[model samples]
Target: MKRLILVVYLLITLGCDKKYLEAKPDRNLLVPVHLEDFQAILDNTADMNNSTYLNFVGADDYLTTNSGYQSASYLMQNAYLWKADIYQNSQTGDPVGDWSSCYKQVFNANVVLDGIDKLGGTADAKLAGVKGTALFFRAMAYFNLAQLFCKAYTTQGAANDAGIPIRLTADVNPRPARGTLTDTYRQIISDLESSLVIIAGNSNFKSRPSKLAVRALLARVYLAMGNYEQALFYAEAVLAESNSLLDYNTINATLARPFPAALPNGNAEVLFYSAMPSLAFLTSQQNSIHPEIYNAYSENDLRKQVFFIDRGNGIINFKGHYTGNVLLFAGLAIDEIYLTKSECLERLGRGAEAIACLNQLLIKRMKTGTYVAQVSTGSNLQLILTERRKELLYRNLRWMDLKRLNLEEATALVLTRTVNGVSYKLVPNSGLWVLPIPDNELIAGAVEQNIR
Candidate 1:
């Protein structure tokens, strides 16, 4: 009779009960997935794919790097280029796998969420907390797609421009059209806001979306939209919760040697962070910050010593510690929140506060007495941006920062190259700024390619 009941349910859903009964889910499948699994997946999102995101993140890293590779690598670097330029056949689909990956996360979260609603759980409050975290990851996954595949949250929207294909439900057939920027942001804000409520009451989210994490994400969204006031509001809230900094000063000694491949979370400074996807390409691409950037660091500046690996060849990749190991990213923390706050303050004419926030971060970066902020003569905006560059260099936020600050052109200015010793400008806001949608997906019937 139990088998009969299962057959009836499967038949109702798939019009085929035989397959379902034969598949036979194991006991692990029978149990409700909790915050653990959901958090585990969220803990692994990384910087520009390294290898994964690089396909979609575009070759800004390479094209823009003074010492990096040239057009051959840059041609297919990311999803930003016009399809005609590379694929030429319009078959490459940027939204395909991402659409699938994000939905996988969403599915995991939904199973957790619905299981709590139907099967019941160990604790009502705990279940609710798990639900909140799932919502945050789901939103984050979608937002990641939106920013890269969709147009900016601009005056004109999906009616005229492309937005990433939004996936609200779990169905796989008949993939949907790209959402408008407005609609995409609505989803992001909605998911985050709801998650905040659920996460606020529970304390078990050791590494998942804590109340602070939600706020940090919200601030990031606001910052992206150029909504400085709202950005400041949420950023300030997250900053208040952090008690530590990744202080650049002790980097060399803290972990010692080649570093641990990845920094652990809940550190004095790491509000929330994953070990992250290891960057083994260092052996090949030799990826690192430009030497000019390394030189810019003050002698007193500790971040350079801690975060950078200066090869003294006008190139300094991340130290052996980060890129060597680790296969994760995306947890949470106060670092980005502080940068968001600083930018918001500068935009709002709070120069002193902006500088103060930057100094707070910088001060912690250097020896207690070293590297003070001198009164700079340029726009406070530049100061905030420079701090952002120094602070978040290797974490996958730089390109977005360039976009948010409308500095893509400025970024482009510096991202030129001399292949065969022949100079070439990397084309600001180049079609290549976005990556080509991945090649494998175009064969699928449902996925839509980005404009290129």
Candidate 2:
């Protein structure tokens, strides 16, 4: 029956050639009439596990070997090089899998938000939690969309910069225009702040978001917008609630695989759960770790052992995913909070304080006794930034980090790639930073294409 239901879901989703966002409702499937029905829609991991295929491909964390390069699909190959059109052929269908999935989640959330008020009794009593969770999910979906479709939020031009459309209602509206970057961010923050007040303190299940999850996500949003104060405040607020770390020392690093393959619901550090598909080409040995990043880890660093699989071919593949599944985790975790706080402190010139936070996180990640506390004098800011890169690889934060970090003159970087002996570069603040909307959406007249 579960298999039958999934087949029906896929059939309904795939049968339409109409715009993904404006597709007519499936008359055969049950409408989410009850609160639990809406909750079940949220639980549909197929639609909700936000995939970061493009972000993962676009980031500079991994280098594709010639073999891997040739074997990859055209979409994957183009994405790796920051091409103007990732989907070169119109026959490839819409290249908006992540975009469509995100908004689908938004639609589900909106359904819950729209319908909950019409019901009564116990479901109404539980409305606060339901509403908060729906809001959080919608905010998360929009945030992800903004990062891909909009330019990095800069104070000077955000009011003019185009952002992804804001879909706040569940009505079958066919067309929605893009909002300004400022408007997009305002909606995201408004939803998060609203969620914080209503969401309960913590969830027994990591998959269900809570107050801490909302705070952590807000910190990430502020950090991207270069709002160091709010970022710091939220990071600290979450830490105050809970700052548990997964001690790498306790993990078995000697096995063929190190981290647990199935991160249980009660995993100590994960604040929220979401994952990207571990597509074979991305995680396979042919796509090796960037040499510089792999070499940066010290021999005693437990992450070096637990997070990678060294094939002895002088290249390593990542294995230290928080989700014990093959899927790469893009969820909120305490380690990210610590790093955000540290970056915020350093950016605010609280050098000593920043190093203290870094030191606290490192103690758990390093070998039991060999870990030495790091001090942030002048050189330590680089250390903290590097640690952030190393810790958050493949989590879909690197692209945003690149955008934000490149804004600072000191840390400005131009990403480069070499494939088949041909080198390509993506300069800092290039228009290429904003990805084009999928072609099908443009053809359908439902969305405008991003300017390249």
Candidate 3:
């Protein structure tokens, strides 16, 4: 069954238009027939679990030298500058870029769902798990895509704003039109809520989705949508089930990679394991941590040493990926949940509770004895946000944070980047925050291109 699916997948990969709007798998191709076959489709982590790296390139977490900027790929270069068109003159049918990659996951999930629907019977626990997994993956893909391709969701604008194509079935011939942002988020939340009722508990493997992962993802989605009460509810749900933070003091900060691999034996705080596709600029020595962010960590904070490598001559590179390797980890973890809970609490005016939640994770990240717990002063919100920026660095999250934070007056940012001798700035609420759809997708006539 696995071999059969692989053959069909390769054939689809080679022959179809990779754009989600126009992907056209051959009608004669074989489809998965059994339950295990569907499970195998979802378990293909390389296709199902990898996430977009463009957000990281565009984020403010890191900067590159002039030489390094020139050395980056054309995609990375334009993304860094926040250009109106990032894929200028790039070929239409490239199968390896972020658009196709995310849609591939969407296609795979739809395939599993179609197969599960055909295998109608009194579903056993295994079948139930498989169905829930499919729903979770589909929701996750849409959420990630929405963050990058759609405008930041606001109650007033979501009803009219354009969103990515919502593909709900395996049949790729149908080019679904770009729906409203409201419908897109509605589908994501509905799928997750359905999965929450179906999935039982945490899976043994972090790569697979479970009830806990569903809750955590829900928390993340609500946080992005600016629904603080719902975000707090879901975050507290995840914390109540499992809230373990890795002790940074125990890590060997001298090693090139401080964290262990996130499989077999990896970080305990991880709820789901997914990573960004590797890119040379992210791992290059020339790609140094932003000075302002790097200097924000206190001397006693173990993360200062545990997460970065001072390559001498004022070059500081990030080595503390939760993936335990070069690939940047972008999946759910307990630390993020704690931060979300704290932020939501602070927004709800529960300042003391928010400070406690922030301290709970901070203590684990600091040196065992040198740490001092933070109090609920007037600045607890800023303090929590500062820690969030530090702890969740390079997790493919900073871009989303920037988008959501910019909506508020106090937290809005005006980002500036100087390349060569020229300067580029991205103002808050600029349409540039919503990236343009690929030219191929526009040419396919399925969706309207974003105005930037």
Candidate 4:
């Protein structure tokens, strides 16, 4: 089956009797909004798994095979950052699939949100928890789509800088306009806060929505808003709850094997991972492990084994520590939670605490005793950012991460390994960074058109 995307609208069907308002919830109009459904949607919608959307939006997995190889979608995306050659067929008309798919996930969340209202007194703490999670996830989905479908998050973006389509209601036909980036983020923050009320008071789905997901989402949102202290506050919430880290030894013992056939979800470092799709040979797809990633890994570095493979063909060899179908690793992991905390803390001038969090995670991954505080102090922020990257590389964190940092910094750092053998540079916050509005949506007037 395709990704778990169901857009249902539970519009009130008017009737003569009061019993009509109390009609049993229809699965067609509403899906199960418990923890199970929340996790299911999250697991299914991961960027790594199969999505005609969501692929090759610059997480640095785009490695070329031989000289003549072509990956159009990825190439066009990379053109805004890193290395991708602009060829004739490189453009994919409109980027409706990405816009549609992300919104589809949001639509699913909205269905749950609406169902919560209809469920009314039938709702328990578990339902409340699910509602919060759905809100957070919907906010997250909109946040990502907005960043991907619109221009950079600049003060200038406050205008109708052409952000992603805003789908607030579960109604599939909710014809909304392209909200401003600021407006979109405001809505995302609103959803997250509302979600926090539901997620925080519940204990049933402790490991699912729990309070951690809300805090994590809060941290992410605050970071996006440039509010470091608030971000730090929430990220610390997650770090306090779990000491989750990607233990290298555990990965070696459990997850390290061959490519997809090996350990599906590589180390304990994995914070949140979706189901591994049953697609054949994952690493060799359009966005494969860049040869630079393989080359950069030290022979002694344990992570090198899980991420790279030495195929003698000299083409591009890969190893996906997490291959096949996805399993939910997104919300409940210690790695990302800690990383989020570390970044937030560092940005908030809590250098020692940030470094401590960073070291805690690094020591676990590297199996080292500890890191020196003095040495890890001056560049604590950079260290935190880089660790987040190293930990979450190719895990679909790059696009937003780049957007968060200085655009020129991104242009300087992104190194495209190959593109028709002629290396190209990314344009940081260029218009190309945002996906072209999907072709179908543009031509048929299905969705608002984005500039090419």
Per-model RMSD to reference:
6.3, 2.8, 2.3, 7.0
TM-score order, best first, reads: 3, 2, 1, 4
> Candidate 3 residues 186-298, lDDT tens each?
99999999889887586878889889999999999999999999999999999998998888888999999999888644779889999998778778899889999999999
lDDT of 4 at 253: 31
Candidate 4, run of 10 with poorest lDDT = 7-16
* Residue range 1-452, candidate 2, lDDT tens digits: 45434633553454325555445545446355556665666666666656556777888888878888899888788888999987777535654667677877787777677767666522453677878888899999999888888888899989998878787866544467886899999999999998898877877777778899999999999999999999999999999989989888889887755556334475678888888865767677787888999999999988888888877777788887777757788899999999999989988988999999999999998888898888667657789999999899778899888888888788889889998899999998888888888876676555667888
Q: Candidate 2: TM-score? A: 0.92
Winner on TM-score (1 vs 4): 1
TM for every model, in the order presented, reads 0.76, 0.92, 0.95, 0.73
The sequence of per-residue lDDT tens digits that candidate 4 reaches over residues 350-430 is 778777777776665543443333345455766577667666654555566676674446223543454555665554554
Candidate 3 wrong stretches, greater than 4 Å: 18-29
lDDT of 1 by residue, 354-408 (tens): 8878777777777777676745344687667777776665555655555454434
Error of 1 at 405 (Å): 2.8
Stretches of candidate 4 off by over 4 Å are 1-57, 67-96, 121-123, 200-208, 253-282, 285-288, 291-300, 313-332, 367-374, 408-417, 443-448
Q: Give model 4's TM-score versus the native structure.
A: 0.73
Best by lDDT: 3
Model 1 stretches with alpha carbons more than 4 Å out: 1-52, 55-100, 120-123, 155-159, 200-207, 253-266, 274-276, 282-285, 312-314, 320-331, 376-378, 407-414, 418-424, 439-448
The 10 consecutive residues of candidate 2 with the worst lDDT sum are 7-16
Local distance difference test, candidate 1: 0.55
Clashes of each: 23, 2, 0, 23
